[model samples]
Target chain A: MKILGAIIIIAASTWAGFEWAKKLSERPKQLRQLKVALQSLEAEIVYGLTPLGQACIHLAEQLPKPLAWFFETVNKKLEEGSSSAQEAWDSSLNEIWKFTAFRQGEMEVMRQLGATIGKHDRDHQQKQLRLALIHLEREEGEAKEEQVKYEKMIKSLGFLAGILLVILLI
Target chain B: MKEILDVLPDTIRRVIEQMDTDIKKGIEEIRIRILRPLEIIVDGKSIIPDSDGGKHVITPQESGQLLNKLSQYSLYALEEELKRGYITIQGGHRVGLAGKVITEKGQVKAIKHIASFNIRVAKQKVGIADRFVPYLYDGKWLNTILIGPPQTGKTTLLRDLARIISTGDIARKLPSFKVGIVDERSEIAGCVNGVPQHHLGDRIDVLDACPKAEGMMMMIRSMSPDVLVVDEIGRKEDSEAILEAVNAGIQIIMTMHGNTMEDLFRRPSIRPLLDMGVFDRMIELTRANGPGTINRIRNQHGKEVYCKKVI
Candidate 1:
């Protein structure tokens, strides 16, 4: 029984560490994909001149799961006639961040981007989009560096901490 | 009615929705003004909402919210419509806005701080043109002009006439003709994403929100419509295009803002066309028995061929 318990604890700790490391590693790629999604969204706004609610819904169809849910929720709130564009965007972003690996500073850029979106002409909207793209791209680079620097450390730390706990308990 | 109220901000909609069923059914327009009581017009009479001996006034905040809702929270997307001073919403309803006008080099730049809105409810009266279509049709389609003053049912009549000509009523055995409408204001077709809300029939093609003159010529070249229809032709270019359409052998049916034949004669843009006998039949509408009331129809000789007494 003691040997079986030891094996189970080690296996669970290793799995948890690997999962954390994997999530950390995926953050940079997710941010980059989000930047691409936003670039296409800008195309829809500038070239197609589609309404904001409609543009968001269209983007939701093409983006990945978390970002898709983000846009889909914004579209729903906009169509409901209850909230303004900024409000809908801000709330949706807040709700979706938990599902994503987006950091707080990255989220601040999105909140600022929401303030000017759909409020001005095509030129102004495109300007806002470009600004957002710049911020996101910069953040994506930082996330990549952070992932490379700390992902392995997180995985190893989890394993070491579990081992320490098991040794202490024993 | 439901669509109009749905688009309205909650404060004003609540008052309009509580109106009597008869008033709601016949409601023509709902006007909203900042810091002013909500008012609706039924048949031509204005009804202001009052509760407990106090009028239900709209606040500035409510007006802003209403504007946002009407624009669907994206004012940038509706820039062109805003330039035209109105936005066409779902259900073919039009909400006209008025406010401070910003100009640049003697041209209107944009309207800012929209302080008032007039929501005109659209009701499509199908087959409303049945009584008058026969008079306009005499074997070959006549180049007809419907003359009516503001708030008259000129647009409504024109819309129905287009539908009937395009669909060809089976009961009346009227053959469908390929019809093209130059809906300059997007009012006739009430198009949402280029899809018409009203049934203009399968044989109809609409150039929604295109300028009348340009649209008329474009329709002629591309659509090759058997009958070309337009609303409110009063520009010099419009006359030039109409002359071109007439010479191209396409029949024309159009409306202009006028109370009588005299109004058409005095209007500078259309006066020359009238003198040139471009219009074969001139139909005058009045509010005598309500909108779309045909007061008289005249021939090219300016003789009244049909009058209200005969009808």
Candidate 2:
């Protein structure tokens, strides 16, 4: 029975560690997906010259789930005509923070992008989007490094710590 | 007119809603200026919104809100319309904008800080062109030019004429002609979502917001219109296309900003058209009898044909 209990505890600790590692690696994936979305947004602005509301809806359909919902929320607000693009974007970011893991600096870059998305000429808007993409790409690089280096350590550490506790109790 | 009020900010809309019923019906233009009193023109007289003859000023924030609504919160999407100095909303109403100009290499790039808006209501008067149709044709359609000053209802007359020519006037027993209109400003047809709101007619096709010169030739090549109509042709390029369309055996019905025959001769762009005798009939309109007033009609020889006043 004691062996059964230790196995259960070790298994639980290992599963929790694996989940933490998965979450730690998820930020880079999210940021990469966001980079892809921003590139498409730049194309929609430059070539299509589509209105922002329509553009948001189009990009949202093309992107993945939680990120897709962020754009859809902004598009809905824009169609309502009650909030400006910047205001809608800010609110959408706040709403999605619980579902996604955008760091403070990354969120600030996106907020900066909202200021010029639907306010400038084609050339100027493309430049603003490029700036946001650059910021996101750099952050994505750092996140990838962190994910690769720390993910394995966190998983192994949880099991080892659990084994040490079991030995002391026995 | 109520549609125009619906697009306005709540503060200014409330002021217009509170206006006298009689005055509200005749409201022609609603002029808005940031930090200035909201003004409405009823029958050429300006009326400021006030309880006791005191002006109700609109704050800058209110004007910002109004712009946001007019632009649907995306100024970038409306950059082209903004460069043209006007935006057409639903119901065919035009809102004229004035602001600090941003030019690139001496060409207008965009308008910034739009401080004033002049909302001009679209008024359609059906059958106003019935009397003029008989004068425009004898056996076949005549190449005609309508001369009028601003605010003289030339556009209204032209729209009705296009409708009559396309639909065929039953009272006058005129058969419908295939009419093609190059609506550069979207004023004549008031197209919304690529469909015309005003009743033009069965055989009419409109190129909404297309340039006059390119659209005229495009209509001729694609639509093969029996009668081609364009509004306010003054540019040299426009004249060249009109001459080309006339050469293609298409009857031309057009309007120009001129009040008299002398005015047509003085304008260099139109002088060549007159010398070519391109126009078979020339009609002049005036605002002497509250717009759509027929001042006179003359043949190609400049001989006056109509004498009595007709509205």
Candidate 3:
């Protein structure tokens, strides 16, 4: 047999070995941080909007790119001077809220997830939290699913590469 | 009649006229260049190759491509036979085509769409299979696949093997063995009916234009000869039939398109056959810087078991 043929076999084996190892290495703790962040976002939406989601919005504002450009566009359209928070909310979220979605869509839908706590809708918030828990499971599978996709991609590449190696060696 | 058709430079009108009067519908002519030891003509143009090697630069035109299109002649696959150096197309009718080798990753898949080729009319020579009588009998008829890429003389080899195995011997005045040939493309015995137009010696019976898969099944039940010789087994279906023949203790001689034995092993389509260990011998051919000719034949171990001079 040609040397190239031998190389192809070796390359295929190595790739298979790597994929086998990757599947064995992932831990549940490494995924916890992202899960926590997703839950916090869920809480804000379910309740009367938490300080965390508001903080995220502020960060999105300071992002200095899409948020900054969008804020600038709306600020210029405003009738008079207003504080940055109101300015940011009115210009950024207000413009977005007018769309069919933000006003009467997901927010209106999420309103039933929580119980009314001192004028806040508790049933809307609770339902939102329940859905968030379900969504967390969905997010967990994303990583594992991605790993599977990666494994397949490796196998396909390895197959072709192995064949080429065989040809080159021969 | 073929000679009369050969004389006129067949134009579109002549083509229509020929069609009206039982004329063949493919290409009317093909310009080919010969490296040596042969002669050719197409549409009044002398077909010869550039001296840079056996590269016959044919002009790509409608009329130029016409003569090699397809034919109604007996199952000789005239053009394919010619390309493999089986017979020479002296004048009038010429065959033409060349196939692109489909390679996957790097392994050869199969040859497809013969772009350039030749058609050589088959002429029978009466007795030629007598030489291999000793090698075939006493349970000597080994199931074989006469493998070689396009134009490596698979059909010619097949015709000879069929002739030898069918008839016991032609030279020593030995008893002719009753042989059945499945000429799937009519390229083998050039059978017009049950009769063979080409020389397959006296011992061979031919099945023409029948698919190898169907022919094998048909021949097994009907002919039941000591040996089964066929040409160009390509797909998995064809292999299955050959396998069935092999499993039934019926000896088979077939061919495939592969230049070397190593190449034969790498082919996914043919790989199963190799793994199954059916083919006793694999004949490989390569055009040796000249016209078409066999390079050598290798045993199952890929050793040069047999070599022949182009006589």
Candidate 4:
């Protein structure tokens, strides 16, 4: 029974470590997806001249989950007709941020983007989108660096900590 | 009309909605200005709705919200419209904007801080041109020019004429003609996303919001329309393009802002077209007996063909 408890405890810690490592890895990938989404948004606004609400719905359909859910929620809020574009965008971002691996810096970048997304002309909108892309690129680089530096360490630390706990308990 | 109401702020929309159906039906324009009472034009008269003993004065926030809704929260898509100082919403309703002008090196770049909006309601009166069809169409549709002042329903007449020509009136013994409309201001067809909201029939094609001169030539080359319909042509390039279309054996129906035949001759840009007799019929319209009242119809030689009898 004691051996079984040790095995279960180690397994739990290792699983928790893997989950953390996965999140660390996901940050960079999610940031890249966000950049692609913003690029598509720029194309839609500049070339297609699609309205922002419509563009969000389009992105929702084209993108993968979490991001898709984010855009879909934004579109729903916009279609509700009560909230402004910025309000819809910010609210959706807040709701989806908990589900994402995005940090506060990335959140701040997106919030800034929300403020001007549909307010300006094409040239100004394009500039604002590009600015957000630059900030996201910086965050993505940091995420990648953290993932490389800590992912393996965290995985090993989980096993090591579990062994230490087992020793102390025994 | 619903589209127009959707863009208005909540309070004004509610008041307008509560108005009598007669006033609602006759509504032509809804004018909103910052710090001013909301005014609606019905048959060329402005009527401010009574709002519980206090007039519903338009606030700056309301105007901002109006602009936001009109743009569909995407002002980036309205780059050209901001420069043009007007926006054509869905259902062909036009909102004229007045604001601080942003200029770049002597050129008007765009309108910013928009504080005034004039929402012109486009009501398509189908069959308003039926009586005139017998006069305007002979063996082939004539190169006709509808002359009128602003708010005299020239576009309404032209829209009906396009529908009639494109659909073909069996009762009137008129066969459907291949009609192409170069709707420069998006007025005649009230097109939304290049598709006309008006009932212009299946045999018609519209070049929405294209400049008159270039669009005329484009229509002739691509659409091969039997009759080309254009609105508000007074520009120099418009006359040149009309001459080109005429030489290409295409019948052109167009409108100009003028009260009388003298108004046509007064403009140097239109003088050459008049001298060449480019227009087969010049129909003058006036609001004297309510909008769309045909004052007189003159042949190419300036002889009266049909005149409204003063009763």
Candidate 5:
């Protein structure tokens, strides 16, 4: 009965300690908050998209073809032992990122990371986070552009209808 | 036969090293008659055969043994060379293999055996078949048959007939009819890959290395010629196909390996064909049976024309 009581006490202590450690853990909180904010931005754009806006959003949401191909080439170059994986990855990224205009605010993060993280362990991690944020911003920007185009098309249609009504009256 | 081999190039022996048993045996009996000795051809570069310390007298037995070492690819190539009709061998030998044949199926197949090969040094008798040319055509064309035993110049005459029918000679003055040759045996055209190696004439379109019945039908479809020339019709399929061709308004000039018309009646497979009478003429050849030469040419309605008697 004493051994049983000791076992119960150890289990309870372990459970309490785990609960305390979890309360102290900040990494989960940071990651969860970051993911939820990024996802919310995506969901807002999806819901607000007109047909043209949705199409443009879909295009912006896609990983750029050249960038994907660049990553694949680096992986191939690493396999062929032509260059180090880090070097290959950095060079390929530079080639691919040339097309990406580094903007401030939502986009400055990508430019800052691209400038600072040339070839380092945290470089890839920094760039990956920046790319994800930038791609989300691009989707939003394209969706807004599509909204403008849709407005122009509707205005032109309204103008055409007005002209037709005048002609019918004549 | 020895004379026949004389025309084959020295390189051909090595080319046929991987030949089958029958061909190897056939090569063993061939002799060179054209090219001079001490010739060795390796991939077209003429080197000298070691010949065991400069012994030039390579007998046919030795030739056969040497040929057994060649790859089968070379044998196929050698067959192609033979299909071209004539080539000089290691010691200036001449050989003939392609011919119209009566295959076991009573169909026309190409003859590849250098059997009945004659090496008469290829004396170009320009007007060899001149006298017999006019008789082959009866108003339109008398569907002729050339019958002879092995080596009795049956192929020689067949080749000549093809030449004459395509480009008529000056004396007989034939109108050069459109001739479709099923040269499955390569005899009439001596074709190598559908190109004539011998002078089968410009009017002849040949189907080389094909079965005779199939070749005949193929010719009828493609050429649409008035007359079709093929050698050796003994296959039931060939026998039937020839009848089909005749029914389709195509005249056949063909040959069979037989001494008498009775030989055609004897075969159970060819018997039905004989009764059907696709071939309207029967030409009996005999070196011993008659005063000799091309003995007799008889019409299907039972009339005979006697040629020069071989004394």
Candidate 6:
């Protein structure tokens, strides 16, 4: 029963480590997905001339989870007709920020974009979108670098720490 | 009407909603300006709706909200509309915007900081042209021009005429003709994204927001419409296009801003068309009998065919 408990402790620690590593890897991948989503949004705004609410709904349908949830929340807020576009965008960003692997820099970029999303003309809005893309691209690069540097070490560290605990107990 | 109310701010909308049904039905235009009492026009007279106790003075925030709602929270999509100083909403209601003009190289680019909104209610008076159908049709639809000043219901009559021509009057035994409308201001058809919001019949096609001259030519070359309808033509290019359409064997029904035949002759831009006798019938509209009242209908030879009796 003691051996079983030791094994279980190691397994739990290793599983937790893998989850952490997975999140590290997910940051860059999600950032890339976010870039693609923003590109499509730019297309919707510039080419399709679709309203922000409709654009959000389109992104929600086309995107994967968490991001999709974010857009869906914005769309819901817009459809309520109470909140402005900026308010809708900011609130949705706050709600989804916890679920995302994005850092503060990315959050700032998104918050800045929400301010001008539906307020300006096509040319100005397009410029704002491109600016957001640039900021997000920088954030994505940093996330990728962090992922490569620490993902493996963190995974192994969790297992090594669990083994050390087992040894101490023994 | 509901669409117009949808774009209005909460407070104004609530007041408008609380209005008597009779007053609501007669509402022609709802004018909202910053720091002014909200005014609505009924039968060419502006009346401020009596709020519970105080006047409903419009705030800047309310104006901004109205503009936002009108644009569907996306001002980016309204680049052309802002430049045009008006937006045609769903249900063919036009919201005229007044604000600081943004100019680029001496050209008006767009209206920024919109401060005033004139929500013109487009009521489709279906079959209003029934009485004039016999006068307008002589075995074939005549090349007609509806002459009227602003707020005289020329567009309203023109829209009904298009419907009549496209749908064909079963009782009058007029066969349905292929009709194309070059809606320059999007007023005649009240189109939203190329689809006409008004109930113009199945055989009608509209080029929404296209300039009058080019759209007429495009409609002729592409659609080959039996009857081509255009609104508010006074430019030189419009007359040229009207001549071309007439030459192409297409029946043209167009509107002009003028009170009398002298008004048509006074304008150098339209004088050429008048000299060429392009228009077969000239129908004058006035506010004498409240809008859409036919003041006179003159033939190509400038003889009055019908005149309203001074009662």
Where is the poorest 10-residue window by lDDT in model 3 chain B? Answer: B67-76
Task: Encode model 6's per-residue lDDT on A1-170: one tens digit a residue.
Answer: 87987898888888889999999999999899899999999999999999888998999999999899999999898888844788889999999989988888989999999998899998999999999999999988988899899999989988987888888888
Fraction of true contacts retained by every candidate, in order, equals: 0.55, 0.45, 0.00, 0.82, 0.00, 0.84
Q: Going through the candidates in order, what is chain B's TM-score?
A: 0.93, 0.94, 0.60, 0.95, 0.64, 0.96
Q: What RMSD value applies to candidate 5?
A: 26.4
Model 1 Cα displacement at B282 (Å)?
0.8
Write the residue-wise lDDT of candidate 3 on A48-155 in tens digits.
Answer: 233322434433455434333433443343212222222333445445444211123333322332122112123443454556555545544665576666756665
Candidate 3: residue B107 lDDT (0-100):
63
The CA lDDT at B157 in model 3 is 63
TM-score of structure candidate 3: 0.42
Model 4 per-residue lDDT at B227? 95
DockQ of each: 0.58, 0.46, 0.00, 0.83, 0.01, 0.83
**Which of the numbered candidates is closest to the native, going by highest lDDT?**
4
lDDT of 3 at B111: 37
Count of clashing pairs, candidate 4: 0
CA lDDT of each candidate? 0.86, 0.87, 0.51, 0.92, 0.52, 0.91
lDDT of 1 at B20: 85
TM for every model, in the order presented, reads 0.91, 0.92, 0.42, 0.96, 0.45, 0.96
Candidate 4: tens digits of C-alpha lDDT, residues B1-311: 89888888788899899899999999999999999999999977889998888788998888878888888889988888988899988888999999899999998889998989999998888888988987898989999999999978898999999999999988777899999999888888988888899888999999988999999999989999999999999999999999999999999999999999899999999999999998899999999988899999999999999999999
How much does candidate 2 score in TM-score?
A: 0.92
Tens-digit per-residue lDDT, B12-112, candidate 3: 22432423332232323433332222123332244432333443334333222232223211111232343332222323132444555546688654334
